[model samples]
Target: MQDQNSAVTLADAFNQATYIIGGHGSRKVKVLQEALEQVDGETFSDHYGNGSIIDEFQQEMAEVLGKEAAVFFPSGTMAQQIALRIWCDRADVKRVAYHPLAHLEIHEEDGLKELHHIESILLGEANRLITLEDVKSMKQEVACLLLELPQREIGGQLPAYEELESISAYCREHGIKLHLDGARLFEITPYYEKTPAEICRLFDSVYISFYKGIGGIAGAILAGDSDMMQESRVWKRRHGGDLIGLYPYILSSRYYYNERIGKMGRYYEQAKELASLFNACHGIRTIPERPVSNMFHVHFALAASEVEPLLVHMAQEYSTAITSYLNKTGGNSCSFEMSTGDRYDLVPQDKLRDALTWLDGEMKKKRF
Candidate 1:
């Protein structure tokens, strides 16, 4: 157990440590400032979602996703909710379906239901990816079906491409709109050995986050057919997502997306490598065993309370922070998420090896 009187929390320790292995790196203000340092703000005029910077970024993302058009939103939540609502409105059915653990179902505080009055049909068990069978078995008619690639909550697991194709065909045959919650779409491409457009061609609509694997300041692109995107623009404005100037988010998104998008394969490989190291440690295992993307869940055989002190000690002593917190999964087990990024490349291999060795020895002492 951590000392009650200790001044440093696990998060503080992780943040203060010399080496941190997680997404991008410190999300300090300077990260955004540095990304904008090369830009001349005076040379570009800010316009409300209609001008060069925003319009070009939206067009670039639409081409990348193989959609006819794309609309930018301040957040993925807004973009996604609007996308689903648009589909539902088009189908004349106020119902949608998605995984039970989907961000819409779990994270959005029922905004889809309350704001749009759209009923959500959960398609599968919370612990697993929504299989094609799950979609085929749905008894209810839905306006749209939302599929998240590399399902984020479940350690970034993804369905096989064939299964995705089957699901897409089924939805199309039934006149059901298919929307992709592809916040991490770019991260999964290397795993599937496909391009962004190839994977996105499977869905009627797609939403990509500039902040997740792309390491942007914050923004999202919602792309689909020209008509749907025009409708979404109206919806985006209705949702107050259209600000006078989103250049900070837009420019930062473009800058970092270009910088890191090409490195997703490297991040995916690093995630698998890191997961293997965790699996090698006693009482620790990674979800999926092999990562399908640059993210995975780390499960500990000990309670979160027990794990926190150990992680704090590792960060303080080894100066290598794995994670800052753990979520209790059950009586004796806890878990935390690990997303590989630029920081993982910075960690000394020997230091990481030694830290894991120390962790393994400690876990053995605890018999966990």
Candidate 2:
């Protein structure tokens, strides 16, 4: 059997093939033109963080989120950590509540604790969505509560809007600030049947990534009241997040925002159709069984050892890539995630199904 590193290399190979959307792979020249064309007169932000494309994008995001103001950061990690620190400072509690699977909890390497001296009170089960009851049960004094819309780590699961409303109310009554880790905020709007402004009204602060679903190179926006945003700019500078010129990231995000924001509803609908196709096949299962957003997980009842070659072989044979990577989940099972977008919409459904059917056939042949 090949080593774990080899499996990652095989995954990289599939990315080079024609795929129906996994990453933000449109033509390189097209992406460049889209970004450059957006540049009108000025292309740079002022010395600290003001005046050009950066200010324009921040204003646009704040309007979309219905917040008093917004600030852009180099990354969601910096944006979220700074947000939590601000809340914790205001309340003087230094403790926050969130799911164990939140990106801040799992991916940030304890930056909150190490840098800001803030503590996290983990809420809910690792595999399930957090509920109102989970917050009610927290015994400690938490300065804030952080919730990820369409929770990323556990197959993009989302709580009912009613439940979310209840949680929001609960936080307000308890004097706990509510913050949204809304990296995929745009992707969940279709399910809520609400505008982004309407949804964001429930939280004290909201942070959205420019790169994930929006397909920008990199950057994040943190939106809140004027005071909070003003403070965030200070934090952005202290953390060295204030770049001299954020034109490229800003322009790309704006370009994709105009082009793809309206297409998210279509992407969500297509994802549901694709999920139904996968559920019908043997030896394959989709998490949550139905996708609540543009993204979902697919599990295969085969080892990475057995599946990587098939992925490579299928890409070569069909001149198309079905998926870019599959991570080892447990004993013999492997899992990968999919987020639907323009490239996915391009492929004919029958051809997409044929690819999955072929994968199922290969896995079934190994059973006997």
Candidate 3:
């Protein structure tokens, strides 16, 4: 087995592979250049979030989300924090509920607690989706309930449509505002067989990321009723989220969102196909076994130390990179997340098949 430090070397080699089977594409300068290629600098302008470019995009997103209004934020962290604050203030409660692994709970370094002074009530176990039973059994009152569609941490799994509706109805009956942490909202539409607006209507407010599935530079849209939007505008300014000119992020968001929103179903199908290939291997399996969105987690019954060298060899010899790194998940097991996108379609089928065949044979050898 390779030393612990060898994972870094393997990752570096993986990045240099001719083909990578994840994400929209490489994050090179050309990505920005391509997004702005047709955008005319002179025609669009915004000052502190109040111009045609920003206004029109906000309106379009509001319509898409079935909300009365939408406000663009520099980051989903800021937007979601402010959203919970608004709900808490309205209900005169300082607590919000969400999955144990919601982005704000795990990734934000307690910004929601420190910046917004809002307490979080973790809803479900760390390893599974939050069920309607979890919401019904909340021991304390919370001003808002947040649900992340296709929970990212647990292999992009989603609750069934009926379960979601039941949760939404219960929240409404209890006067608890439901907000969607829909950073990858567009990516899950194919599985639910519902439009974005249909899903957004279940929640009181919805937040969508432009960078995640849309492949934008960076930005998010917070959509809700007119009253909530007006309040959010105030909070956005207070948080310094309103920039003098956000045309770069705005234009790229609009460009890529329009370009890729219709292709979510294609990405979804690609994800299932790829996950099946991974599952066919001797000791590898995807988290959900079947994807509910464009993304899923791949687990190997071998330690990171055992997998890194093999992945490096695959990249070097097959010119196809499956993943760059793995996270050790206790004794003799490791995992990594995969999200299908434009690059998945770009990989040569014959090369991908041969690479996986080699991987399966090697994994069997290691296990035995």
Q: Number of clashes in model 3?
A: 0
TM-score of each: 0.97, 0.93, 0.97
- What C-alpha lDDT do the candidate models reach, one value each? 0.90, 0.84, 0.92
Better of 1 and 3 by lDDT: 3
Model 2's lDDT to the true fold? 0.84
- Compared to the true structure, candidate 2 yields what TM-score? 0.93
Off by over 4 Å in 3: 1-8
Looking at model 3, the pairs that clash are none
Which is superior by lDDT, 2 or 3? Answer: 3
Better by TM-score, candidate 3 or 2: 3
Best by lDDT: 3
Per-residue CA lDDT of candidate 2, range 1-368, in tens? 22334444555657666655454575466786767774665544545687755777789999999999999888999999999999999998889999999888889898998999999988999999999999999999999999999888888999999999999999999999999999999999998999999999999999998777788777889999999999998899899888887666777778888878998888899788888877887778888689989889988888887788877766655555767677899878898888887777667666676777776777778662
Candidate 1 least-lDDT 10 residues: 1-10
For model 2 the local lDDT of residue 360 reads 72
